[model samples]
Target: MPLWLLLMLWRGSVAQVLSYKLKLQKSMTVQEGLCVHVPCEFSYPWLSFISAYVSWFQKGADVNQDPPVATNKPNQKLHERTQGRFFIRGDPQTGNCSLDITEVHMGDSGTYFFHLGTYSYLDTMFSLNVTALTHTPHIIIPGTLESGHPRNLTCSVPWACERSTPPIFSWTSAALTSLGPRTHLSSVLTLTPRPQDHGTNLTCQVYFPAAGVMVERTVQLNVTYAPQNTAIRIFQGSRTALGTLQNTSSVFILEGQALQLLCVTDSNPPAELSWFRGSPTWKATPICRSPILDVSQAGAVEEGDLICQAQNLLGSQHISLHLSVVYPLQLLSPSCSWEGEGLRCNCSSRAQRAPTLRWRLGEELLEGNHSNASWTVTSSLVGPWANSSLSLSGPLGSGLRLSCEAQNAQGKQSAAVLLLPDKPEPRTSGVIEAVAGAGTMALLSLCLCLIFRVKTGRKKTVQPVQSMDMSPAGSSGSGAYQHQSWTDIPAAPPAPAEARPISEEEQELHYALLRFPKPKYQEQEDIHTEYSEIKTHK
Candidate 1:
């Protein structure tokens, strides 16, 4: 052997190996109830010398048992489990071997290995791949309905195995023979549900030859709902009477008159009949063959609307009846001494027409009663309306119970009120007298102030003669008196003092001769003169 030759052969071997790699032409996936074909191709020049045996095996360590292969002679040991499920085809000249699988299941998902036999009598690994197949189909049903009406339901499988030849569909139920064509990949069943169908089980089954297995789903149906068409009827009057009709046709009645209200209704399964004056004030009564509600005449039955309702599984219906009652107009019953002075009472009548009112004390009708009473009347335009009242305040401490009676063409109604004496309010005369006395004192003080002002004014108007002189000390007091007397002399007569005319110098000397009392006294007099001068300046 030569080194160059050895290297060349190694190179040649590497190139050939790379060029002859195996390849699969087509890959396939099949549903659980279907079939698939995996086609493969490969090239190897040296292996062409001897016809290679084509073998296929699930990729596992125990491949010898489940080998999927093509051989001229059948291999009994390997054909045991895989006999019907797998088949293979190959062409020796082209070096191609492809395998087909039927009735694929979830367990069949794995790599498949292809092997080729060589002249050396050894099988060589050619190609490997993964095969995916669907598992068992799951069916689901969402809901069901019952009673009132029919409803449609749907049945569905998780996946469709379209590859199965002549896909099979079927349903099973005890209520019906096998549902053939109606069953599909996704089937819908519609029918009016009855109580009997509830809890019934339904099954949808599909079969496939390729898979050699059946896939099925089951569901239980539930049906439930309410009942229907409730109504009512009224009897006792000429208007559609159910029992004996009354002679008179009147919706109104006077106080103390006998009255009855009848209520009736028709229902399936016979509903319980109940009587109610107002809402929630219900009383259960025995239902007769001809169910009717009857109420006795009572003072409390003034204007009121009565409602009747029928109820069953299906639904409910309600109807209303209006009642009018009239009674005598009366003052409120005088409350007892313990009850207080608020004495009030009511009068009502169910007469068909408006009634007249009369109030009386004992047996005699009183004129004062009419004067003390206030009246209000109300009229309704619609079919049955009621008028009610609340009364307040009346005479107290009258031992008698005042009666008010009302009469109509049909009958008369009356209501009485008892009077209870109330303690009179305490007298406030002393307080009023105190307030008046205080006012008189204030007025007297004001009058005194006015009288003082008028006296002062009169004194100012009447000038009085000064008996004593307010003159300088040491000076002749008679001089001031004489000066005043001279000034007081009337203008019609000339004073004797003024007739004696004195020279200017003599007048000055005379003033000099008239000396002030003392230096301190003169100083004080000068200060007074200075002050007067300041006042004049200002």
Candidate 2:
């Protein structure tokens, strides 16, 4: 009796173990803060009219004491650890048992089993490996970034579950940016790119509060921009930088100097720099294709305007440099001629800048069109040329130098003429001495006549002696009487000679006669004026 009963029980237990059959995915891998779905189906012996419920529980947990992680029953309670994150999605009436887990954490890593009513299947289960979050946020750049243009950028965590707590999104960038729309797992950012923002890093960070994990992605921005901050640098030589010019400017340079100019600008893509001769347009061919422009001394004569241009694919910019070449003052040889009792001199000069003309007469600086007692100076300036006329009318000094000088900011120049001594006139001096001796004889005759008149008065002689006074004779012919009276007056004392004996050294005095030859181009009559300087030896 015992053998038959035990054989029946053993067969029944084996049949019950084989009847609870299930099919499901064996193992699944899910990152923390993400979701996973385990597809499962099971066939169990049950009545058709009775309603059945499906449930899921963590491995090594008591189904009766510890609550199930998921349940489809109306009044069944769930595990606090996975109450909202774990659920059984399929209907039990259709023999479908799919386990869905959202916001899976590291603590949820283990084996799980499915239960249908009072029956449980442990052989057909799935293992969830909840690894550390390794997924990064995705940065979506719709198109090319252009400077000064605003565009929307999207940062999303598409792999994260929507049922999980919304993640906090943040953006970090050096560009001008503002907040845009936000969804369950993504955030939008409105970005305005600038030239300076090129090649800069933009980071998108997502923080999952439930999992206490954060993920981020960084991308470098490529911004297209136009040429900006166009400027020209002036270099005096190869090594020295004089200054920087950002706008149009006028500059002056010495005649024999060289200049070096460099153009610079800011842009995303490299800009092309060029140098133009004058006010040329963009279509004109440039004098220099590089950024550096070298101006040699030979080209200084053609000074006017120079332009520097910086162009890029986006836009272009330029600056102008006005040039003025200055030269030193120059003076031509002075021309001199003799006018009526005066010496006339004309001087002409030219220079880049208007030069001042003046006359230099023996250490005296004479300027302007003013007149004095001895000399008159008249000057005129037109453009770069200057002309001056000097007239001297007075006692002339021998061995004197007269010079014409011109001066300006660049330099000064002068031209001079030397006056030479001339021989004295001996004939003109001898007649002056003879006239002095005749005047002395006349004075002595008058004194002798006065003395004779006094003696005649003392004698009381009534007879009038021939009047010895040599005076102008009346209407009568008394030419011979006047001669006799003059001879008789000489009986008075002979006048002593006041003249000194002349020595060889004192015989001749030096005189200078300055005579200027008139130019053939002049139409005025030739002047005969001459200046003579005479001096006696001491």
Q: What shift in Å separates residue 143 of candidate 2 from its native position after superposition?
A: 3.3
lDDT, candidate 2, 1-538, per-residue tens: 7999999999998887776889898999999988898898888775355567778988988988889999988777888889888888887787889988888889999999988767779877889998999999999999889998999999999989888899999999999999999999899999999999999999999999988889999999999999888998888866599889898897777778888888999986889999898877747999999999888782445588889888888988888998777766767777766787777888888877778999888989999989999999999887668999999987576766688788888778777765544322111112332453355455543332231223322333222233333323342342222322222211223222332333545332222222333322322244332222211112
TM-score of each: 0.32, 0.68
**Model number with the top TM-score:** 2
How do the residues 444-464 of candidate 1 rate in per-residue lDDT, one tens digit apiece? 434322211113223232222
Candidate 1 regions exceeding 4 Å error are: 23-43, 46-53, 58-78, 87-100, 105-112, 117-170, 174-178, 182-201, 207-215, 220-538
The number of the candidate with the highest lDDT is 2
User: Alpha carbon lDDT of residue 422, candidate 2?
Assistant: 39
RMSD of each: 31.3, 17.6
Residue-level lDDT for 69 in candidate 2: 91
